[model samples]
Target: MHGSAASVGPAAADTPSRGTLDELDLALVNALQMAPRAPWAQLARPLGVDAATLSRRWARLRASGEAWITCHAAPSQVAHGALALIEVSCVPQAREALADRLARHPQAMSVELVAGSCDLLLTVATATKSSMTAYVLALGRDEAVTATRTHLVQHLYQDGSEWRMDSLSRDQRRDLAEAEDSAARTAAAILAPEDRALMFALAQDGRRSIASIAAELDRPESTVRRLLHSLLHGGRAVLRVDTAHVHSGWRSSATIWMSVPPAQLVSAGDELSRLRSTRMAASVSSEANLLSVVWLHTLDDLARYEAQAAARITSVRVLNRAVNLRWIKRMGRLLADDGRSTGFVPIDLWAPVA
Candidate 1:
């Protein structure tokens, strides 16, 4: 499964620094990223660690909020709605409160306090264009929000679900991919309301046991298991383990907007998604429609990566770029000031607006 992590509140003064992740810890995280719910035995052999050791390490990581796994509506589900990236310029003093307010909204998938032209950036999903427009208009009326710009996503080539920790060996990744393919082909069913409820529960904790979900939903264990299988294999839901970028050797992230011919859009998006630095790649409704976010070891790496990308994807022209200074919330999870996950708020992207 694959989902994004969230953030909330400022980091405590004693918050641990990013340098704490050791080599083994990084490898374990990469393994989980490849297969979020892979059995401990399945993951242990490749990492050269015992199953028990893997489990204990993972438990520690989850408890410390340095890492976590959660489920999200798959790309297919997100495509059923109107998805947009909103740039908000808010009054300096009200930025924090405004972020908190936006973070609580079910439609706001991500709320970040960023640098550059806008003070905040939000990725929102609404059921329709009209609803999306209404949300934007409402934001424009907020006294704290001085201005806003919305870019509707036309196509998402690569989202958080596609990002991987490249720490694993080629053979290891190949092995994991085969297992995932096997699981993916096991079921194909349309999602129902109860399935959505299961999704919400999984979103809160991807590692939640089958028994727990069954108990909470008041359903038979076998039924819940079957539904979970359908949701996973049918691609209705995905699970992702999120961690601080700093811990992954990526200290900075930049959003790049590109302009490409309509004919080359898909090819260009595909090429961008193949890049190691890309976190997200999509075609949006704007002059610069090809939007991508890339991680870098430092701000200086942005120019180098951009030049390389421009050369490789000759059909796409670079338009503009912005840096994300701090992420206030990501994927419905509240983050601490230092980018560690502190809590979660289940993303109800399709929740009705009244």
Candidate 2:
């Protein structure tokens, strides 16, 4: 499924004030993480907060860009296509400019300035193999890019959509999970032209009022409402919140490559997905069959995790890893120098490369 986009803006004059998340804030975030479109009253009942208070707090979070929800095409829609993690080596001085340019491109789902073998890392999506080849060729020809390496994703085990803050009580989580399970029972259908338009609108803001979307599409409100409900509940689209990791106290992130026995791949991936640190995990078409993006409270945790993973998951072997030095763009939201989300560039995963 899809998420938020990066926006371009001037750097902040000072670091945005860091506000700590109290217990209620964490619970609210965890609840929304489970069901991004859950009505405030439903959320409030479990959290023991009034619907009005919950609504007000959510507004504040969105306004501050600390957290907000957006929509993306479901995995079934994208699995037939190509997704690649691109390692870009560019002129040191041109890194920022190049990252900004890639962040603005509709196909780039994420771009990061990193301390690895490459200067920038990009997660790119394209609808077909030819399009993917063309996009990679275009990047290779760019004057600023000196070299590039791309690893095609084969099987995604756990995407960011499955990552959670784990701040809710077990009973609270069970209730939310039940609601989601019920909604997911509907069968998914192919997207029509109008459905695509609605998805584009929601990609900008998952919580956008149905009336506004109907007006934009020039369709009756009832029609728009029905289409949206079908898309979400039918598993045609994924709605998720993109939050600032700094605010959530997750200050470090890493990308890992691993080798796994073919017979053990599924079991290993399933086990890795359950770890609290995993943000994204998948099998790729390379010497390394498994790749994972993990979040940590500190840089030191990476070594500890690698050691523990090797010791515990005997079927999987760690091959290589890189820490994300800075995020140029996450989901679709561009990060300012201070790491606050400034603007959005909608992720159009199925669009042809220009």
Candidate 3:
């Protein structure tokens, strides 16, 4: 539930300080990771803080541009077919133009300017194989794009890599359990060190059995079972939702770029969300001019979305729709960075109920 979109590697250390996050901050973040839209008062209450402080901290986090709340969807479940990671080699000067073009595409999930092999890494999903092929061919037609390499996502274990939330301590865990007395425990905390060791091993191969986990963790099979169940119900920590790009029926998926007036954004976004085809939409900060990204299931669905947008926002731009050829690796790292995920939690996604 706690999600991040961060740059990894050596520069990862050079990243700016995240500021001091105390017990309350950690608690609030964990609550939000579970439900990003939870009410300020609700999150505040459990942490023994007031609404004002919670609101202030949240605003600071947002203002600092270190944390955000975004929606994620299962493309296959939405009837979109393929998924792909695109690497684009472009002239540094033209990178801005290329980014702008890709961001407008309805097929892209996320895009970033990297420092390595490819200047840009674009995650795209599409509806059908034919559509995916067409989308790629269109990119080839772009004169600005010198070369492109597509990596089909075979499977997704994790997505996003921002670490705005802090890890938890033992006392903090007890406090959480006490505060939310009736809530289910997170799956990550149930494992012993040995069990966790096994989990790490099994994560590399999802098919790893309890016996294997036990052997790896040097624990008994019974302990492994208990830990596995805990991981399942405890916020799904040990295992995550796994799916291939093209499953039984769904064919592909795509990212939709949108432009909206600053004034009309709230109202326009609300209206667009009423459509069933839209899985998730968010206002993002990008180097390109585009302001928003929407995930859609089908091309017809996309057309309908455009019509709706025309009535809501002043103008809508369809940059380029990339196809998701396959799913690559997904969320797999330890949350707390202590070889355990006990202390790491994300904020809730939806607002708390009255």
Best by lDDT: 1
State TM-scores per candidate.
0.91, 0.91, 0.41
Residues 1-354 of candidate 3: C-alpha lDDT, one tens digit per residue: 122222222113344434344555555655555444345665565566788998887555433333333323232222234566667888778986676556545455545555445667676665455566676788777878888877554323222211112344555445455333122321223234443344444443333467877886677999887766554334333232221112111233444445555565556556555544443444433321232223344445656666776766656555544433322222221111111111111111121211
Q: Write model 2 residue lDDT over 1-354, tens digit each, in one string.
A: 233344433234443445656678778888888877778888887788899999988776666667777777666555657889989999999998999888878889889988877888899877677888999999999999999988999877778876788788888887777544223523436556676788889885787898898888899999998888888778777787767787778888989989989988887888788777988878888888888899999999998877767776887788777788888888777775545677887787667676
Give candidate 1 misplaced runs (Cα > 4 Å): 1-18, 181-190
- The lDDT per prediction is 0.79, 0.78, 0.45
**Which wins on TM-score, candidate 1 or candidate 3?**
1
Which residue runs of candidate 3 sit more than 4 Å off their true CA positions? Answer: 1-27, 75-80, 161-165, 170-354
Cα error of candidate 1 at position 292, Å? 0.3
CA lDDT of 316 in candidate 3? Answer: 56
In model 2, where do residues sit more than 4 Å from their true spots?
Answer: 1-16, 175-190
RMSD of 3: 20.4
Residues 1-354 of candidate 1 have per-residue lDDT tens digits of 113334333244554454567788888888887777778888888888899999998776766677788787777665666889998999999999999888878788889888777899999887667888888998899999999988999888888876877777888777667444223422234457887899988986787899999998999999999988888778878887788767667788888889988988898899899888898999999878899989888999998888878887887788777788888778877876666778777777666553
Worst 10 residues of 3 by lDDT: 336-345
RMSD of each: 3.5, 3.1, 20.4
Q: Between which residue pairs do clashes occur in model 2?
A: 2-72, 4-332, 5-332, 5-333, 6-332, 6-333, 6-334, 7-334, 7-343, 7-344
